[model samples]
Target: MSKIEKLLKKLCNPAYKQNVRKEELESILNHFFEGQWTFGEISGSHNYRIYHPYFKNFPEKFGPEGFLTIPVSGGKFIKHFYIKILCRFINEIKEIEK
Candidate 1:
């Protein structure tokens, strides 16, 4: 299994399903931002760009498409973008739930 699969499994584990404090969430993001953490598609050597492309114009071509991404630097470095987008998406979702 890939690291992302492992991470997703671990994250989905019922044991970790609890309210995450604001500080805790910030700490996790900060850790990754500071290059102190490494997991899945995120790394310290690349620049990532994230996009939330709107497919409302063509719903048939794309269904409920929310996010799109591309890497401008660090070829073959998709993890950086994945981590960035994932973290941002999670934080946003949490905020909405709160």
Candidate 2:
């Protein structure tokens, strides 16, 4: 397996399961963006735009409402949490691309 895939598996291990906290998510994001410059660079122009939509009901895949549903906990937490997950997903995709 690729380095990114291995990193993702380690980050999303069953030990943590779906109970990933804000701190853990932040750490994941930090690691993912350690060398990356921008979200567009990490996820590609098309996917970066799709992942960051202003409208909620634009589409199921465009938003994080589908992939992550970890009990609402204020707007800040929700925003950062989804951002981290998106970064993780994009990193995984980059691994596949390699």
- lDDT tens digits, residues 16-83, model 2? 33434455444544554453322234432312222222224434644554222333244223234444
Clashes of each: 3, 0
In TM-score terms, which candidate is top? 2
Q: Give the clash total for candidate 2.
A: 0
Clashing pairs in 2: none
lDDT of 1 by residue, 1-98 (tens): 75544554444454554433333333444433344223335665333322233323344543455323333323342333344445545455457558
Native-referenced Cα lDDT, model 1: 0.40
Q: Each model's TM-score, in the order given?
A: 0.26, 0.34
Local lDDT at 38 for model 1: 31
Overall local distance difference test of candidate 2: 0.43
Highest-lDDT candidate: 2
